[model samples]
Target: MTLELIDIAVQDSQSHPRLAGRVTGHVRAVLSEMLDGREQTHELSIPVWADIADGTSQSDIDLALMLKAAKIVARLKLSLQSPP
Candidate 1:
C-alpha cells in the first residue's frame, strides 16, 4: 500500500500561534494509529505547506484536518486488508 499526502494549508500562523502544533499533533496521531499493528511494508510521503491568511478558527481547522486524515487512513487500511 502507498500513502500520499495531498496538501496541508495553515493560514495566519502569526495570528494563531497554536495552530501549527495542533495540526501536527492531529496528523501525527492519525498516522500512528494507522501504522500500528501493521506488518506490511509500504511507501509513505507527507508534504506539508503553510501560508498567511484569515478566517476559520483553530478548532475548526483541527477538526477538518483530523477528519481528512482519518478518512485517508481508513481507505488505506481497507486497501491493505483486501485481497490483491
Candidate 2:
C-alpha cells in the first residue's frame, strides 16, 4: 500500500524544529502498519487538525496522532464502501 501526506497542520503543540519531521514519521509509520498486506494506493487530501497540550510527551502525541489518523482512514474507507 502507498500513502501520501500532502500537508499537516498542528496546533498547540511543542515548538521543536524537528516536530514536523517527527509528525511525518509517525504518520508514515501508522499508515504503513495499517495498510500492511494491502496492495492499494491511497492519496488523501483532507484537512486534519489537532490541538495537543504543550506538556504532552512525544510518545503520547505520537500515539494520539496515530490513533486519530487511523480512525480517519477507516472512516474514509467505510464511506467509500457505502452505497448512495
How many clashes show up per model?
0, 0
Model 1 C-alpha lDDT versus the unseen true structure: 0.45
lDDT by residue for model 1 over 1-84, one digit each (tens)? 344444443322223355633333335321322345463433333222233235766766655655565566667768766486
Q: Please report, as a residue range, the 10-residue window in candidate 2 with the lowest summed lDDT.
A: 25-34
TM-score for each of the candidates = 0.40, 0.44
lDDT of 2 by residue, 7-73 (tens): 4323333344544333332243223223556644444433333446657677677566656666677
TM-score of 2: 0.44
Give stretches of model 2 more than 4 Å off. Answer: 1-26, 29-48, 82-84
What lDDT is reached at residue 26 by model 2? 29
